[model samples]
Target chain A: MLGLSQQALLRLPWRRSLESIALPVIALTAALIIFGGFCAMAGANPFQVYGSIYKAAFGRWSAWQHTLILSAPLMLTALCTALPARLGLVIIGNEGALVMGGLAAMATGLGLGITLPPLMVQLAMAAAGMAAGGLWIMLAGALRYYRGVNETISSLLLNYIAIAIMNHLVEGPMRDASFVIKPSSAELDPANWLGAIPGSRIHFGLLYGLVVCLLAYVLIQRTPFGFAARIVGGNIRAARIAGLPVGKLTLAICFLGGSAAGLAGMVEVAAVQKRINQSLVSNYGYAGILVAFVSRHNPLATILAAILLGGILASGGILQRSHNLPDATVLVFQGIVFLCVLYSESLYGKFPCFREGEG
Target chain B: MAAESLGLWGIPLGILAGTLRGSAPFLFVSLGECLTEKSGKINLGLEGVLLMGAMSAYGVSYLSQDLVGDFWAPWLGVLAAGFSGMALGTIHGWVAQQPRVNDVATGIAMITLGSGLAFFFGKPFIQPQAPQLMTFDWGAWSSSPQVQAALKVSPLFLLGVAIAPLLYAFFRSTRWGLSIRAVGDSPQAARAMGISIFKVRLFSIMAGSFLAGIGGACLSLYYPGVWTERISSGQGLMAVALVIFAQWNPIQCLWASLLFGGAQAIGPTFQSVGIDSYYYLFNAAPYILTLIIMIITCSPQRTLSGSPGALGKSDHT
Candidate 1:
């Protein structure tokens, strides 16, 4: 009887997983249809617009390079939300952590001057960024665990505060004298700049993102700690009864997630911007939330979702130039996708095929 | 030396003026959120709603000025903003009621949708000059031109102030208000009492959204007096935090909003007095204040008595 019940449970999840995948796919298709209607209302043929988007984002070698570059940061930041989500915490202050991480990295680079070896300086910058980001997000976790503060609200408010702090530093005390037009820190020495891949325009950050996400996938799916975290997420009261270290797990997961986001900021500074400035606080943090949600908080799936979103963002300029549409037009598409995906959550477990004894 | 002292005194006076002017948007948004939360749903998407409202209000004011002249344009623009907010709120309410929909995630999506639609449609209105709402020169009694300029108050500001006590009375005395509170505190109990949870919550959300839209209109049609992509600047989000700080009391919201307004005014006030040091830090005061407030009020040891029991929780039934 035990073996039979176990077999039945195993069979049910396979069908359940199939439905989970099918529902989101359907939602995405519906969202695309709605987006197409909007485009048609704007006087552009929806098919032509989608075709141009595809051509611009993935059709050419140069386009692929751009998408890969954008995806690198997104993958890292998406982890920020995904990991915390495993503990049933919604942390959206990845932007704040990214900004602070970038600032910390920049400060470390400038503070070290040129005394250390180039590799050492780069390592130090990464460390600074990770530490800053980890602490910043950990504050939200701590607040939630200890103070009953809502992680979502606290983290988001922290984003505003972090940006303000960055602005204060960049525009005031840390302003580089020669960089008058835009207040920025002194650029990192050329020796410290992250090198691009030999055959492509994409840098080492893409590899870093993939490796980190893979490691995260392994940790979440294959570890005892992850098992405990899942238990906590499934039911906190039960987790307490089980004697699980819920507080410690929450803080550790939040820290790890925040460190990934911080590293993304460092990569943006070292590999792309080559300096820290106001531009570092781009919407990658917010976009990562969408990516995480689309991936259903799975680290492995986050990589694919990040790349897809990166391609959409990469096509914005092309849409503007070719279709006379504003760059923000894509935001409408993303918003629709987000809504449909959230709505699709209702469709899960309701499908007839997934019903017990159907097979 | 006398002029310097006068300038010093102007800082306080300027802050007082800023409190009255700046608190209007905060007051309206917080009250709106307050009403919604009282019905057991938190609409964090009000940030995006405010942005869309601002954009639509500006666009309508600009268009109506061309068609009907300035006399009626601003009021018509306010109406358009409220309508836009209601539409978005309806989407949120409907989605929230759907099975398995997470209110927080849905709220986030709504934010993206509202802001995306606003930005996509607002491009044309960026350069147009919309008719601005009129303001009363209450400072005319002062001899200083500086004081007179500082004291210019929009009529919307007065309306926001008046609405606070009215909302307090609404919650205290009205049947609908009691119904909303009942739905919020105990949905099972409310349902047993023959109340329709869906209708009460949905109508409450729509009404709250209308108030938030008025707040957005105040931002574009009065103070800043121009439509820009950044007009709302997270004021709607800040108002969410403000509602918590107010402990869900409408009257307390007035005091909390003024405090936030004062925090916002610090930067400009200091600048006017030639104290440019740490200006950006001063600009960050409101966010800092919000963080501090959340820390103080959100203690796990004590339950927040004013919080609606059902707020932010999914109703499995």
Candidate 2:
């Protein structure tokens, strides 16, 4: 039998929340210190390097716009991992879904041509992209739920296959003869291109990302479906005993998550690249995994995490130019952050201060 | 085209040679992953480990060639690659063993860390040439020059083939192997038997990573013979899927790796036949095949009999 104080120490709700936030914050600081040491070793002043990173990422309006541009796709892609995570599925195939989505969007746009209104064409593109992305991830979920295949490995393998398919289409059938230097589909008409926000270079994808993330937050935190998904995630056996449609929930969550990533691809095609190409398979999908992890799989938190990561990405060129750091310096920082965040998991619920109710 | 240079007989022979050549990396990586998974751990970071090993091997080989005589440089490079892999694996094993750490997430982090470290360190080793591992022409018996050239097999490939049986035997017969199996099947049982689960898993992960490092060395020092960022191109990840396809049996790993190697060889074979239209499609075949195999093998009705019971689960102890 435990004493009263021991029981209290184990029951502190606020303490758990505090420790969750504190541990990550501490880990972030530690990672920065370690990375600063790395920069110093590379013959750059650590303070100046950090200063440049800050300035380039957030100092000027233009820099802010660039960061926002980078953040938009990340916000959407992070949902691919974050949402399915609620169902205890680790889907890393968002890259595959994103590329497939982009391909679908491009194909739809090409098929629709100028016959439709620009707004209607964009909607069709988004629908096609979402549907394609949803189906791709649903396949992985179906494999996991029906075939018992591990989603992580299958999704990753699917990513490679998706990239291969993208390469085949772009280099073979979809190649625009005029663009021999870089194989790509024909560009979208300027009228159909995603317009910039008023007085800013940032596009409407940023708004879409924010709205989707908010909607996802509401869906997860304020809905019965989200409650059922959480229960399934907590314990599949119990969820099954409780008569939850475990398979349907898994499939649905995966489809929704995948659709978010698909929308990101659509955004990339309609809003930024304006054409499908190999570059559509950028590290944004991978980076989104990092973002989702850093946010602890919270959809709302993912927006903030994406912005932070986006700024870091936008600052890469400046770090290379001013500090003589390698182009991959940001990658090293990201790696450090990821490692620290993972290590920090050990600190949760173990802090003395977080222990319940002595006072 | 290089394939055109070889005739009809060369296409089948080319695939055979390619199977031997390409399967080396897969065999080593899958074997390593098998060892790790058998110890109740999964190190998805092997992709990054592969890249880092490739870079380290290339860097060491180039440096040793400049410092020491060329004769011992390649061997030294392979050793360095193995050590580097062990070091990274050590970090992963330690971090993952810590309380509350998620193995999958930790692996993802390690992937970034290893690849980032490699890219940063590998910038300088891009241009300088490193001594390549020696190869023997097994097809020397053939009258054609193309046959002889196509059958130029690296000693590493032969070594990989030989290791499969030895590893299978080790898992079946050795005391340490039994302990690893015990740990993987049930940590609670292993602990009751007075085994230190931590030590077994750590050592298994390190040893597995060492083998994976050797696989990377094969890529850089023998087959591709270059230090580049894209040298691995998800071969390590492919190896992970292959391990599952092989049902975690080392002998099956050998066969599965060859199957994958054959899939990879299809492109070059088609090119030899003057059908280069779907080259990217051929390159994509291995991944598609892996997915298909996984789909067919994975069944929800029953747990995979070959899976280590505790694989990927964080040990409370």
Candidate 3:
């Protein structure tokens, strides 16, 4: 069983929060063992691989910065999944939103005639990106509310459509025309670009993602709308009986989730890539789902999960370069950890220690 | 000149060919999912099963060096895929039956696992071409270019078509199929009648995944002899949509797969015709059609009722 119930966790003092961390600690240990087996299968030394991964992901300050850079988008993308999940709406359109957001941010950069200050351009890009993403998800939510379509399938279809649209635009209309091999839009001005953290390749996006996560946590856990959404997710019949505005709330939360991911997209464009390309999707949206699942939909826990997974992702290039392991080696490890973490859910209410008097 | 370029004759012919080639994988995967769903368990992991099937089939055929052609390669690949599917399904059934693990979440995870493994193995096959299956040259009967193109159906297409009536007959007449359906319709009722709901559902998921694996294998061996990471991109997931579009019937699966195939083929058709706008529209067609079909079929009046009772019966739904 998971160690602490909602009521118990709330009632416990700050000292008991340490006990709650036990689940993830145990889960992380289990993950290492499983990944060790995978390393054996791949004909690599497990200890050596582990050592290399640690060195590449966090042993150096630069590696840790890169890890945070990767973690930035994942954090917001986690919200894109986690928020709607609170309302029992599986709106998996974050990647699509991210694409749209990137397009919007790129377009803003291209279309803006006046040379504004860096802060103003960044703010405008974020707003535009979030709007594009928010609008895209709003359509899905609207269709689910009014037209009775399944959001999961529609959102997924929208992702393909968005990717195709991105491809078409970059290849045909918005293409810079000079770059023959890899078509991309005109790069944003370096003056307008986001600055990196002091002495790190990491940008301010990590701070932004963490702030969004904190805000999402408060919105989902403390706000009235969050309370109503939970009730709706639990039971629509009960929610309707309780006079909750289910349809509007669904649309609103979905929009907020989309905006979070859209912001991540803008940050990627402004901070990391500085150009919108097909590489916008490095499976961050998909990986975010695993992060959300491992965190059990709690926004704050997603930070740790995303950072942990980000470390693995950061080390993937190192593993591929050093051991000649396939880049997908990281994928296998993530898959193993994801499956084990999910399976560990069975332990939640079953543990004798968590039983009435045992703890 | 416009009329000649239009090649109106090519439209129907291409649709027919598209239906056969495109629908083969859909047909196979849907029939498998149909069986699984009939037993009251929906396994979304078929997408991964299909990917693994493609990888294994392609890997084996490439290693075999085409001495025997790729004819038997997919069959062998399907077997491996089926074995993998059964293994994954067993885990799904076990965890789901535990009353703690969520089937949908578990399925999503298994999908990632299957795809990860497929890409790991499929990395070796990015450039080298596997031995392709020999075409029967059925176009010998037709002089027209369009007709010839339409006539060249893969043997897997024929195999998938053949599976339709066989599955229909099995569902209508066979004891196991009927028991599976009974368990799906009402596990509680089936349990009352002394049936093992867990056992039936387990068998259903395994069988469903096996068929999906064959469908995946067909993509690599017959259609295009090369494998890529994106080869099975949305085919597996789209097949899930096809099951709903087919109304959970094996015969309907054929029609549904063909329709999906036609929609998919339109993108290439636009390129061949040199219609730039059509290219964009055509690319968007399948997803739009699928979304429309889902909305229409799932409408209040036409709501599907014969699906496995447990399908989508989540706490939220």
Candidate 4:
């Protein structure tokens, strides 16, 4: 028999990946148990509360529809984070871009004063939104490339600026004076409105988000651009030595990421809210970070993670109403899961058998 | 109108008031960050610390119903918030101290966790009628309402002012402070000199968190007197940026915070005057300015030379 250290080093590769996946699963289940205890403390039956949460989030047809609706924007916004992350750029400006995109869509729809078909209007809106977001993020990338400013702080700062800009437009110039309590842009005319999915609250936006995710997966996994981005992310000096257009790659990904997030704003305005408003943020940008983290920044994994998180978000309203659980409980769970997952990063590359045991 | 608002005259008065309101939180967060950075680690988790402070301070003030009578409430709430930061910071320090876990990742996780926990406890305190803390009326000298409004200095403002010079002195002149600074600048050198870098960083993060917690308390207890989901509103993050803008000098930090505060106040001032357009740009002015400043100052080949060498150094190897 092998010694204890040798045995510990002899774990299978499949087992390692399983453990990588299992850690989060275990953390989530443990969270449920802890939250269940919290539910019990708050004078609710844990079993019943959990049952209701599951039913409201994913068990029923209507709930599934809500899940899809929520997942659509999350998937796109998560791409805003994931794509930039591949280039080692921590761009948290997705919310800001989303707001700008929605504003762009609203401005274009109203400014042109043309009555177009729904699909045509959506296409136009998407293009407008994408362009706005693209420019916003490219500013950060440009600053980083040319000026040596840290992208994380600059991107985050830009996000604040973008939101402020949106708020100004909605509250000042672009506001439809007819509405009060919450300022908003003029509602998109009915001809420009996006249709709902056949069976539920799901919309054309979900399909768009999925297509983007698929496209991102293909781009990252297949393209020469993807290869260059990966090399740059792994090492900047090496990437430059390899004769790669490091600055161009960084700028392109940032633009693409920002556009994806901007599309979220576009879809929300055209297909869901039907107007540009302050509700554009709704912490979707922040939630997208959690979705990206849970998926470990993999584009394909982000889609699944978004669906899971969307379910939790959809269930939050139900939990608050039914079990007296605070709506922020979902946020708390996300925080815990995120922390646990990060802590579990220690597990990666630790097994000697998985590695070649080379120093 | 732009010319009327221009020159050193208009901006300074607005900046003074802004400094008073804005400096309180900056004083606490930067001081806390100073301490943490001195310990040779960074805690971007101050955002969560501020939120928790706001929630707990509001809850405490609401529970007591007398602002000054329950002056201890905010302190207690601050302590609670500090402990929360310490707990999270400790986990961060421990994990980062390990061979594998990245400091940036640890900080990000802590931020997420701290904010989540704050939101969780902050739920009940959202609607509480918080007792407002007393304000010092430095504006009483002015006859003009505009001048009066511009000069209404807060007690917390004065406190922040007093704290900056004191902290600057403490970090530069004191023995323990030197030790903290030594560890921050070079852990290898510190270890050679027999100082524990780990202990120094641990101490600094805890202290920085305490100050950040007090900043949060000031927001809820003194100025705003209410709690909401957006209570902190990235103030904690901006203050960290402000640290860089200040070139990591406490005195410079005082000026930077005031500049931001004035910029913040400009939006409301313009709104009050009914100059309706470009309000978004006005609101965004500070962040944009910050980005511009960051770009102008940060060198392409080398990092900012003025920073304490130990700040934000990743133990990646």
> Can you list each candidate's DockQ?
0.70, 0.69, 0.48, 0.54
Could you tell me which residue pairs clash in candidate 1?
A: none
Q: Whole-model lDDT for model 1 versus the true structure?
A: 0.87
Residue-level error in angstroms, candidate 1, position A119: 2.9
Candidate 4: regions farther than 4 A off: A1-13, A37-47, A112-114, A350-359, B1-18, B37-42, B64-116, B126-128, B139-153, B175-198, B308-314
lDDT of 1 at A147: 91
Question: Is 1 or 3 the stronger prediction by TM-score?
Answer: 1
**Model 4, span A75-183: residue lDDT tens:** 9988888898888777777778788888898788776555666667778888998888877888888888888777767877877888888788788788899988698
Candidate 1, which CAPRI tier? medium
- RMSD in order of candidates: 2.1, 2.6, 3.8, 4.5
What digit string (tens of lDDT, one per residue) describes model 1 on residues A238-303? 999999999999999999989899988888898998777888988888888878877888999999
lDDT scores for all predictions?
0.87, 0.87, 0.76, 0.75
Worst 10 residues of 3 chain B by lDDT: B1-10
List the candidate 3 regions with Cα displacement exceeding 4 Å: A1-20, A113-115, B1-16, B64-74, B93-100, B143-150, B299-306, B315-317
Best model per DockQ: 1
TM-score of each: 0.96, 0.96, 0.91, 0.88
Ten-residue segment with the worst summed lDDT in candidate 4 chain B?
B1-10
Cα-based lDDT at residue A10, candidate 4:
61
Over A1-359, each residue of candidate 3 has an lDDT whose tens digit, in order, gives 45558656555543344434666677678988988888888899999999998998889888888888889899988888888888887766778888888889878876762477778888899999899888888888887887767677678788778877887887777878786658677678887677887877778999899999999999989999899999998898899898999889989988998888888888888887787777887677777767777787899999998988889889878888888888878877777778778777766655545444344
Candidate 2 per-residue C-alpha lDDT over B5-79 given as tens digits, one digit per residue, 9 for 90 to 100: 566766787788788778888888899999999989889888878888888988899888977768678888889
